[model samples]
Target: MMYTVQSSGMLLKRFSANYVQNSTRLASFRQCERYGKFHDCRKRISHWLKAQGEQVAQACTKQCEFIIAQRIRRSLQIFHLYTRIWDEVALKEFMKSWRNRALRNSRHFLMSSIGITMYNWDRERITKDELNGYKKEIEGIYRLRDSTVVCAKCQLRIVIDVRQSGIKYCTCTDNKFNATSNQDSEGWKPYIEREDMLIWRREEPNCGGLFAYKVYGSFAEVTAEDFLQAQIDVDYRKEWDPTARELRIIDTDPASQSSADSHSDVIYWETIWPKLFANRDYVYQRDWVVDKERRLIIIISKVTDHPAAPSKPGTYRVTTYWSYMVIRPYTEFHQPGIEFGLTYFDDPGVNIPSAVTAWVAMTGLPNFLIRMREASRNYQNYKIAKQSLDASDTNYVPLKNEDIFEDKVLHGNMQNSERSEILNGKNVEDYNKIEHTEVPQFNEDLKEEEEEEDSTNSSEEGRGLLDYFYLAKLFA
Candidate 1:
């Protein structure tokens, strides 16, 4: 896809000029606040298999284990279409197919392990008419067919029904799968259209120059904070608290223009979702099963053992290190009352991290709730000032800097701007496209076993869509 717009736009910059810059830090977070969504924020998150996690996981395990064990027979028709979309997503996620130590050495072994692929013609052959509904109804379906590919160093691949077609420009992770040099012009335009390419905006008064940023090492620093002391703001809320054994949510963006925001959407555990996911099964996982019952959109994520990039001194510095994060559809929040709720993991704030403490401070709540009244009463005050401030004002006014607070302090969330607009439409046509599909209902059905191995097949090689969800840090 193409993002060639010169309509007098503001260029994005890193938090600092001296920080070491990488594509993720320099390009991803400069315009956008944080690199990843802080999904791990206050999650009842655990690497250990909790009973609840185990039960739901067990249900999914049944399905995936079946697939992994090669025990289930495949219907050529179903496999045909699934293979195409799988190939599409897999190709798009080529960066995620890197070979880890755990990945078998043989090419065929890895290919079988990686994913299933098919073609567009095969998919068109589907007939999802409940009346004529032969349409393949599987979980976790996305289409980026309308989107195009652009690669400077990355080689793109698409395996259709075991056949392979790759783009010379794009390469899978580890630069392993090589595609033909001939780029397909078919999907490029719409594909580009589907992306919310990191936009760079410096509005009135700030004048583009006042908000300039650059990366020196592994950092992105802001050279100036003209209007106010810029600070990071995180939107924290509970998804599912295993300790609490309940799901909670918060409006990370309280002032955001929406009611019933997740932060604001408080509810209790009414049901338990199926736990079909296993920790990265081996460093290079080529297979996963998505059951329509429990998982409609399966997010993948991880918590860095430590900060992604070290922090340094800069007027406005953005660390290059990994932070607790999540990536999902941009519209998830746009939904009337939708908020990110956890089904996989949770936190109880048993031992709040310094990061969470610092986050509270950055939010002008150094003492936390003690300053609640201040914000509660002054939210309107800030709103008035928010309207009056100009882009280049340089007023040095006490800026809300909400986005900054989220990125630097909160380790905010980065929505999945790269959604497959095309296929997502098809999903909508099928099942009303509900934001939160019904997950498994929580129950007392459990037969606890002493223990199981870590099972956390941490894969540093390929990043999963789940990366956007679990990697987010937790305050609890």
Candidate 2:
């Protein structure tokens, strides 16, 4: 009975140990399955968060693009509006100019008829032959409106056609002619010589046979472009020219007549006269051509009627006037300068002695040129200051110089036969055959008022009208 009881206790201890081992294994497997489910849930939540972030980033980029597009649309709309406003303004100005031009033409016609009648009626003072001769001379000058001239030095071709209201400059490289060989061929007589300047005179049969002067000289320190700017800068002229009593631009060429490389203006100039004589006023059309390749500039002015410059009471209106200037780059004394040829004539409507007139032409013209040269030298500084002021202003729209200096291929090369014909002067029609290349267009900016009241006042003290007339007493 004791042996059987011990065997039963051992069997009970073995069974309890096996049951404990099985329970620990089942508990560890349940813990591992729970850990795996938690990890899978965490991974799914992280993927959802990443997708939401990507969608938000895409939404922000679209919003920025939409805002930028809206700003560009708004800017384009403003630009179109401004363009329309400018177009309307330009139309109005054109109509007004047309009306004024018609009125002026009628007035000039009536005045000219009256003068012709008076001229014919006065037999004692002027004979019919004399009158006819004067008319012929005047017509001859008018014919120059459609003339061609070649530069003596460079053989550059220049065409002036006022009927077309245009001047054309062409390079004449193959054709050579010596235009300056015979000065007397053009009826020019050597009148005077001073320093390096040579003066020639051509007598007009009308107006008491007054002498018209032509001068050729070199400006020591000025460039051709600066000298040209000095001539055309009306405001700057007021500062330096003592003889000018009034100078203003009445009108500019209509847009139809203007081109990229050329400009024209109607200007009124009133010059001081001697003490006993009345002031002389001129209404003229001025045009200029700039040839960049040749470094040349040509300026021509002729009398024109304008309603804006009606005859003032005290001033003698000059009815017949013509002036032209040709300037080219020249080197003198190892320095680059300007060589100029100027021809000027006008009817002063007075009977001054020929000797006195000759003396004034010899002395006054040189003095005037000297002043112009000095003024041109100072213009560089003036331009810099003016540009600085304009740049500071918010409303200023700067005017761009025409891009005419760009290199261009010739329209068509002339054949050897054509060049020889031109040289022989047999093919006059081919002189203007070279067509200009189409220049790129730019928006025409509005011109600002160039003169200020303060500047006018400051310059008034030094500019005396009497200084020009002081020497007249010696001849009077």
Candidate 3:
């Protein structure tokens, strides 16, 4: 949405759009207009409640499914199953409970944060030209997020955690915190001159001589005459009387910076304030493979030819290649976010039964779920065609292979293997069927599929490839 601007008889190239002003506004509009209109600050809690509705659904309904399920597994597995059936629940006790809590709380975050009065937005009908102008504006805004990718073909960084105590020689010098010098009284006069705006510690008069002042934008500490004297320098105009808590622009005592403890407390709060109130949506968005750009044919329905969709029943067959996929939950989120993974093979013929729905229910992360649902839709052409259903010739059995398994999260290897051995075999269709039914079966079948899993299994101390999985039945 670029436009040519003629200003002062010179053509200037610029961009603008309605979306450029706010990511939430743009992304929300792309999702649905009703969401964008009613979910502003005034309606934020209502929207938040809707979000909690999903969370509640995740808790109550998801848990209920595990209780009523025909198949039973471990407690962890039960939690996993709960996620799979979360959206299917008919009632949400959790949502009702959370909404009640919100209404009753009337706390600061509930009142000030989610309230509609917090933001500025335009709410008028826009004409085509006006819309186009906004479009260009937004394109410009998005350009900021378009990073100057250093390496388009960069390999994934190997994340290997080294034990801190094991390192003997270090090449880099780590900076040790030195708060002692900062405690000197020399800077006190200047420090008080700049930051000595004081507040009564409490409204009660009996709170005594206690007073607090903002040290940084985020921290507060009790005031002392010493802190004030440390900030001044010789030849400065200030003076101070310790008893009266008075100061003028006089020379400061460098040694007056005693009590290094106050600075530590200030540092702690300075580190915490922004993180607690920072953009929470980015935390949620982190879980997803967001804003994917790929080459896809513009598909439309027609009498002469039909656009195939993976979502439509019978449009695809369960193929062996993609039918067997492996996923391990990433429950320990480094940040506030959902955790899950999805990998589909290009040639596998096994039907992915509402994979988007499955993943949404599986992770219980709303933003991640939405991203996956929208992103997975462009793969209709990669559908496992129905013809693949009958590709199995019993005699021409695709050689079954010994499974290869590695704990990548616990180890440096990414669970990818290059050693595989083709063992007694079965038709690939059978393997595909098992994969669709058992999660582990797919992982086992992977040894057969990939070029790396070509060696014989010799290690047998731990769980076998199939037995190692927490619960593999869902894929079967």
Candidate 4:
């Protein structure tokens, strides 16, 4: 119950009759002790009522806070699911039918307007004044995700700054925030910076409270295409990536090779761990998006279940995580190269030693970046040899120019050498009809060593080296 001065006054009026009666009796007695006793009793009652009012006020405040928190949480859940679905549907439709920009805009507007209405309803119900300090915290979390939007009237695609715009939908008519032309858009704010590489980690939803880090830097002699090719090529990966002792393609589907669809692949990766540490392995689904219009190539990998390959022994399997690699062209400041933004997160199946984890965290990524560049360069050099070998396997015969003086001289010498056989045989040119071929040279020992190394590193059959995985699964 809420106490007020008006209510107190009414209560006092009701009790005034009793007080008056007592006062009359005391006055008749004309005793100072009787008046003193009456005054003390009135003061005690007032103090008791005041204490009760304070308790009621505190309870009301707590109830209001609880309501506000509940509303915020419910609204956030709605917003998260709504935005995620919106992104998926919009991207699918836009990619599938680029010519239907008008239809796409209408659909986007309808979806976004509905989301706004839903959010606004909750916002008003939340009662901004009641939230007090928690209002900022709730909105900050909601703004953490990037807003995907499209103009309703113009049918132009864009990504708006949710925090800055203060709305979920775009009001742009001229497409100022157009996605295709926004290569220079701001990146994630760095929370961890070292040696010119900025790394920022943020808690993502539906991730079991895990964190993912954004790491981007300029590496020498690497272009957007170079990095894309290097990351995707299976054989080239082994050359540069020292972390992964063995990487294999578990399976792949190329049915989505159309202009509208992206390619997906399932890969198995086994990483090299220290002597004391158990090895780590992963089976992940990777999706590739090579957007020529935006000059961006993105590869996203997420952990996935592959029954073809189960958890093996002696290795801890990463249970959860996703990684993103974004490649873009560099500006003059980072000229003669490209810029790569890499974001990765994973939960190792086992506990990691703090010292080893720290050491790897400090040196691993930088070394990987450096080695990736080196590997790209090596692949470029080795490509010439690879092409020749491929050509020989295909029995490719190249055309030769015979108009030059050197070619005429060689032809004459060959004719001179075959003259004696031609004169002796009834068919003169038969002796000179044989073809000559050159054998392609390659290192057999190196090939043998690579094959043997792969065999040694791969687990035997389906069994793993350790029993802890089985025990954990059984108990889990």
Candidate 5:
């Protein structure tokens, strides 16, 4: 039951800086990305029930619906844990108790044979062994116990459990509840959905920052390694993330070495913005870890100070933000592929209002994610082509499409689009029409019926892990 404390204070410093506030605890309830409202876990289930028809919903007992909601909540908490690690003493103690309770509960329920299997949002199965393995990992955190976990959902400090639950909400105790028969419970709702992307924002009372979640999936023939490599590749990132004007590693922790095990570095981020707004810059410590056995990769970038990088002009310096990315194999719908969950909150260091920023997130964020998927596939294809041929071969040369088109334009074989020129007996208009392909939009109506569940003062607060996963199940 003993925990290690950091002598260097680095981990302690990080925990202190990213600690969540009580008021923001209620923000943990999954909200509809469009309306900027909250939905109770029960309402989400009720909506599902009603969809099954009035007879089915009525036939479903309150307890059965509650159980479903609980399972979903547990599934989501497990996903949240994959995003980051929490090793604080209190969290360790909670996990220990929860682990003991789960083991005991399993035995009492005659789960001693083959154990049980739990399904996630993507319908991915998590076995009892896997859950126990996750718990074992938490137990191993005793070596670095000073590291506190910031709740991915509530933005608060939390001790997570694998089953029948522990901490799902923080001190700001709204939106925390296990679904009972009462369908009148209050909760958050989905605000917007575009394709596989879900965008939700809440005015965080904790830090006065606009908290947003951009959850999306990348369904290309890309491997988890490929996706993670692209995330850390600065040069490759610039091509995909159009907003990234400049990205460079500015510093690194002397204690952590550059190896495949993990890498810790301070990066400088300068992103482009519209002419109406100033550009933004961020200097933060980016730490990455790859769990090969679990097929999960987590990257967290937290705002920090570095003597090498200072505030610059025409670029607003982002003083605070906790941005993290979770990448894993998404096997529910497609040929086993990678999916990413990204959550970030920052006080833009500008005069922009939350409403305006929220509007921008709803409209532009999905396109940015789509561009990312396309870019990853493009890069992967380029790599495959180069590997299959000799670089010096004239006929098999792997030239970028832009390079080929640039040569044609220089030779006057083709004119810019404005000229309405012809190429190979085909007009520019005809080529444009043939090449255009529309991207699929997101399904925003998944939980629109639960919008009325928005009430911060609802008597029903979620107490079990099911609250998180039920919404996750619907969305996943």
Candidate 6:
């Protein structure tokens, strides 16, 4: 009986131990299953995030490409528009020049024929009269007291009156009328009066009855030298003169280079005109004489011909043009001032009404003088700036030579054909459009040097001890 009871106790203990072991194993399996499921979910989430990131990157790249394409298209459109406008302007100018040339040729032919016929008839009549003892005098007298002419017909004593004389002389030939010496000469009638300016007109007998104008004015607070420089500086004139389409010194007198007081230049000037009227251009010789003793400056300009400045298309060549100016210090006013007298006349190819001419002279001359005065006031500033720029740049060379009086310099080492092409507008380039090279500022360069030095010092200070040791070992 004792043996059987012991056996039963042992069985019960073994069963309890087995039950505890089974429970622990089941708990561990559950934990493992949970961990596996968690790991699987994390992998799926990572894959999804990576796919989303790739899609976003692709979209961003596409957007950048679209923006760049749009900008390129816009730039191309602007360039095409500019080219189209340029072509249209060039075409219009060409057509206008063609029409003008045709008209001029036809008119010239007709006038030449008429002039030849008339000249022959006049010559025959004059010869016949002289052979018949009817000689005429060259000078006509108003009264018999100064009569030098005698009529050989019927022994009649008659004086050739000035009014009835057939021979007429150009008013410009008169020795008594000097534009520079006399500001108020005979036959000058007061035409326009302003508070600070006066204009007078004298009828030119030979210039198609056009009036020669005299303008006298005083510029307050402007020195004579400044005013003179403003007038003569072509580069500065381009900034102020609205009427000037193109002005350049084509040639300068080599002879005048020997004398400092005397200077001369041949200039090509094209002026802007209204829509219907053709443009006018002038190839003129300008002579200026500076007298320091008298504090007087004289400038004279007249129409002249030049091989370098041939008449180009799209403009009318002004054949008859003259201008004279006298500038001196003004002592009449308390403040420093300049007094100027200018006389000018030009026969524009097309005839304009006298009233329009008078009106233009009255309004245009005063406004021009006013602008010139303003430019003179700014001339000193411009000179100083130019000097500074010149001093700062050692490699700078002027595009146009300063001493262009030499023939070789004026031609610019170009072939004759190339020069003609440029002058005739075939290969002409817009000089104003030429981009000026940006010069480095002295202050900016100094700042850059300072920044480089500071960066080097900072990098040296930022080195770690290990990095320094490595570098030192490498150097060693």
Task: Give me the runs in candidate 2 sitting further than 4 Å from their true place.
Answer: 1-183, 256-260, 331-336, 385-476
lDDT of candidate model 5 versus the reference: 0.45
Tens digits of per-residue lDDT, candidate 2, 1-476, equal 33444455456668766544366755665566556646778888899888899898999999999999999999999999999998999899998998888775765566576632111112212222422232222122212211224344444333211111111234463333322222454666555544334455777775687867766655545655556666777766776666677888766665414354456667898878756778888878776665444444566777777656789998888888777676654321112354566777777677767677666666555455444656766766766666634644321222223353322223213233332212111223321122432111111121133224323433553344323432211100
Single out the weakest 10-residue window by summed lDDT for candidate 4. 467-476
Task: Tell me the alpha-carbon RMSD of every candidate.
Answer: 48.5, 31.6, 46.8, 28.2, 42.5, 33.8
Can you write out model 6's per-residue Cα lDDT over 1-476, one digit (the tens) per residue? 33444465467668766544367755665565566646778888899989899898999999999999999999999999999999999999999998898785654455566632111222222122222221111001011111112122222222211111222212333323222222233566555544334455778887766877766564546666667767677766766555567888866665665655666777788776666667778877777666543445667777776655667888888897777677654321111355566767777766767776655565555445545666777776876776724644321212222232223222223333332111011211321111211110111111456446544533453232211110111000
| Model 2: residue 336 alpha-carbon error in angstroms | 4.2
The Cα RMSD of model 3 versus the native structure comes to 46.8
Q: Could you give candidate 5's per-residue lDDT for residues 149-256 as a string of tens digits? A: 223345443222211121223445353532211111121123444443333334456665555453535353555555665666666666545456788876555444
| Model 4 whole-model lDDT (C-alpha atoms) | 0.46
Residue runs of model 6 more than 4 Å from their true location after superposition: 1-185, 331-335, 388-476
Ordering by TM-score: 2, 6, 5, 4, 1, 3
lDDT of candidates 1 onward, in order: 0.24, 0.52, 0.21, 0.46, 0.45, 0.50
Q: Which ten residues in a row have the lowest lDDT in candidate 1?
A: 212-221
> Highest TM-score among the candidates is held by which one?
2
Among all candidates shown, the one with the greatest lDDT:
2
Candidate 3 lDDT, tens digit per residue, 1-476? 11111231132223333314367744544566444444577587887888788788779987889787745556669888887678555247678878887765544344356642211112211122422232222122112111110111231111112111211222122323111122212121101111111000111133222111111110011111111111111111011101111112111112222322111000000001112221100000001011101100010100111011112232222121111111111111111111111221121222234444233223222222222222222112212332222445111111111132121123222232421111101111211122121111112211233222222221221123221111111111
**Candidate 1 structure lDDT:** 0.24
Candidate 1 lDDT, 164-265, residue by residue in tens:
111122334454432222233321111111011110111113222111110000001111121001111111112111111222221122232232111111
Give lDDT tens digits, candidate 4, residues 217-297.
544454444456567766656654445567877655444433232455677887766566787788777766544333345
What ranges in model 1 sit over 4 Å off? 1-141, 145-259, 262-316, 319-456, 459-476
